[model samples]
Target: MNTDRLIAVLAADAAPVGPHVVEWRIASALSIAACGAVALLLLSYGVRADLAALVATPIFWAKLAFALTMAGAALVATARLSRPGVAVGRVWAALVVPAAIALPVALVVLWLAPRDARAALLLGNTWRTCSLNIALLSVPGLIAILAVVRSLAPTRLHLAGAMAGLFAGAIGTAAYCLRCPETSVPFWATWYLLGIAIPTLVGALVAKKALRW
Candidate 1:
């Protein structure tokens, strides 16, 4: 067969892509996963009893801000990775900014506190279970987002998987804030980071196989 003839034949039946298809699909998948995470939180842990009081506090908002900002950043990175040749560039800064801000604030708070009281700030009441719970909440999002990525054309499989996992973990962390009574910045800087890391590491480890084309 003539090469030009074959190329023309292949192009003849190609369909034009609809606008915002990738964005719509990924957003829809993550929305469903967020709902799942919320439901899991309600069923398993319930909201913090003093939520009404906590709602008026600045620290509560700060915790939510950090988690959600990280989520938004991870979503952008994962979306870029989903395509074949898109440049990721500085999208990672979004992921770092929240943590970067939180860490310095945490250190400052720790430095100002009495030495004996430092442990209480770093290890909140639920430290043992917090990371595990956040990782558990991430499962639904991980499965959902990974499925979305698998259907797309991600070339950088490991990075894509890690970003997806981070997105899931960040959203899960935000949901967890409702049930978590820890009011200390140091605690969030430590345990919440561990929670997010759990899934991110998992994604990197599994990506080569899970994201295989």
Candidate 2:
């Protein structure tokens, strides 16, 4: 084929792309997913009975801040992943910083308590259920996120899926916070993180097949 003719053919078939479009697409999809998750949570587990009192405590807000901040970071990462030729760079720092800060703080909180009380801090009554619930809640958000990512030109499919999963997990964790009665930072830092990790791992594994254009 002549060079000019080949170039023209390629250009014609290329997908249209724009700056920051990924952010909006993923955000819109996740917002819809959040509504679905909330409805599911309400219908299934219902909100905590002491929600009003829990909201008054500092720990409650701290737990939310950890999850929401992770969501924001993952969203940024997913946005970067959705586009080709984009350098993720320090955007990953947003994810690392919160966990780095909170985990140590949680450990300290546990250490300062009486030795016998440490187990309670680590394993709260819901440890077995917490991660599973977070993963389950993340399903709707994960599907929504993958839909948006699949529409884009993500070069790193696995990373894109992982970030999307992280985003979904964080959102799910935040929603779970409303129903969770545990007040220990150690419990949240451990179990909640495990919850987020489950989907992240799954996303990484399935991205090649699921995100193919």
Please report, in order, the local distance difference test score of every candidate based on alpha carbons: 0.91, 0.88
Candidate 2: segments with Cα more than 4 A from true spot: 9-20
Candidate 2 displacement at residue 202 in angstroms: 0.9
Tell me, by lDDT, which candidate is best.
Answer: 1
Stretches of candidate 1 exceeding 4 Å from the true structure: 5-13
What is the lDDT for 165 in model 1? 92
Worst 10 residues of 2 by lDDT: 15-24
lDDT of 1 by residue, 18-39 (tens): 8998898789768967998899
How well is each residue in 5-116 modelled by candidate 2, as lDDT tens digits?
9999989979866776766898797796688678778988999999999999999999999999999888888888888888888988889977898899998998799999
Task: Give all TM-scores, in the order shown.
Answer: 0.95, 0.93
